[model samples]
Target: MLPPVWEVVGAGQSLYEQGPVAPGTSTQVIADVPAGSYVALASCGNADSTAMWASDYPGIEEILALFPLTSFAIEQGATVITVPAETPAVPVQQSPSFGSSQSE
Candidate 1:
């Protein structure tokens, strides 16, 4: 039998990401990305991101299973990406209605 494969390839870049997908919970795979960046895509749990995954929702039977996690690393010469500072959200206020009555 051949080993399961997950291919994520793009112009000279190689990727083989895999993992499980649990209900209502997201799977996050973090990686160090460098400057002079190109568009990078992240997928949590999906048909395209699994090796031998099985799920009732999508009707897949397991062939070979993984605990559901993957790793990403930046190249030695590439700069790592950083998280931006969070900003507070301002509350929105609505105008009050005049003389309104309702019955159920």
Candidate 2:
């Protein structure tokens, strides 16, 4: 069996102010994950800029006897994955500043 596909999703500041999407990003990955138990990490990158970051959500033990286990290892051990520098989700939030509204 193959590992379940995981989709990484989040919202954050854009590296470039004139990009199409702002404060939002997502990605997907497919791996041959085992059925008994395993761990996976999600990586994120700036939509506009090339800078990259990662995060890990562990304890994702899937109990399916039919699945197959493939030897896999992450580059880095378990740790709080780094995400694009953006406004804090809780506690505080920040937005772009505008001098004045443009009249049409």
Candidate 3:
């Protein structure tokens, strides 16, 4: 698995660390982001292992079927969308039902 790139959308800022960071190891990256509700993308760059196993599949079409290159090739990385800080509560009214009535 390749290290992922995290991009902050609408902010034009990104953070990345080149790694085959060892399992259980930790790393950090920082980027200045502007304030606003937005999303981020986590791109795993190129997943080289797809071919290592895919080589056994035997045909171009067959390999592609198992491992979609689009998933591995996406440059946009991953996304981190923001949730609205507060949601306004809607005031629901109890509607009155009409009952049968005898009238002149």
Candidate 4:
């Protein structure tokens, strides 16, 4: 399973990023970004700026399991934006049976 990643994006550009951090673990990310409105997002895979709006990816399950995001702005000085400590629930896909169409 791919680990989660943290990203701060604005105007279709990535301002700051942290991770592919291990699952069930946390880390600190500090970056001096310009003052602007940004959106913080976390995902259980390596979905970067390039694949921001991608509908389909290799591991759609990981992409689909995303954390809650909040938009914020930094007027000046230091700013601290936090990604909530929550685990994304990855959906399990059941394989189809070609042998029989009837339920047992």
Candidate 5:
């Protein structure tokens, strides 16, 4: 039997698209993560395992929504983290008249 499949989504853009990952798969950050909230989805057991298994398991979309950004621990199993964008610094303006006065 295979492990399970996990997917991560950030804001409107999907960081990690739906896919099957091994049970021991290392946690990875999702793409397009905004400075705000996000979601994650996971599915256990293989689809072809059995009808009963599939029926008992929750859908990917449903599971993803169930796991909110707040619930995720910084150090834990497959989880998503929010990354803040860096702000650009403003350029300082120089006085044009100061250096030109003595030239005349």
Candidate 6:
């Protein structure tokens, strides 16, 4: 059986790693994240093994069936997003007149 492990990968590197969830239970891990894009992945087997299984088995139904029987693949998560830089807020102020005020 493959060890259950959690990993956070960013910038093509493994940022954090944790786990080996106690046999038949779940677990939670806290990781310090820096400013960057990252993908969190958790698996019960070796690297890419879960993905391979998913491909070979195919379909959610089949995957569900296989999971309870084999418990090979626990979960797969991936996402990447880009946020546009925000424009700084500029205080609006009325322009001062070049000419001096005339007496009424």
Per-residue lDDT of candidate 3, residues 1-104 (tens digit): 22222222214454445556555647566445444444333333235744322111112233245555443323333344444556669997764554536453
Candidate 2 residue pairs that clash: 3-32, 3-33, 12-23, 54-81, 55-81
Pairs of residues at least 3 apart in sequence or in different chains that clash in candidate 6: none
The lDDT per prediction is: 0.35, 0.34, 0.39, 0.41, 0.41, 0.41
> Taking the tens digit of each residue's C-alpha lDDT, what string does model 5 give over 8-86?
3324444454456666855655555557534443334445533211112223334434543222222224433445685
Tens digits of per-residue lDDT, candidate 6, 1-104, equal: 21122222224555445555466766665445555544444434535444322211223334446443444333453334233355468997765654549653
User: Candidate 3: minimum summed lDDT over ten consecutive residues — where?
Assistant: 52-61
Residue-level error in angstroms, candidate 3, position 26? 3.5
Candidate 5 segments whose C-alpha is farther than 4 A from its true place: 1-14, 49-80, 87-104
Point out the higher-scoring one by TM-score: 4 or 5.
5
Residue-level lDDT of model 1, residues 1-104, one tens digit each, is 21122311224553335565567856556455333333233333445644322222110112123335332222222222334344358897765554456543
**Per-model TM-score on C-alpha atoms:** 0.25, 0.22, 0.27, 0.29, 0.30, 0.30
Better of 3 and 5 by TM-score: 5
The TM-score obtained by model 1 is 0.25
Cα displacement (angstroms), candidate 2, residue 88, comes to 38
For model 6, what is the C-alpha lDDT against the true structure?
Answer: 0.41
Q: Quick one: ranking by TM-score, best first?
A: 6, 5, 4, 3, 1, 2
RMSD of each: 15.2, 15.8, 15.0, 19.2, 12.8, 13.3
Off by over 4 Å in 1: 1-16, 42-104
Candidate 4's residue-wise lDDT over 1-104, tens digit each?
22122232224555545456666768657566555444444433344533233223234334334534322222222233444445468997777775677997
Give the 10-residue window scoring lowest on summed lDDT in candidate 4. 1-10
lDDT for position 50 in model 2 = 44
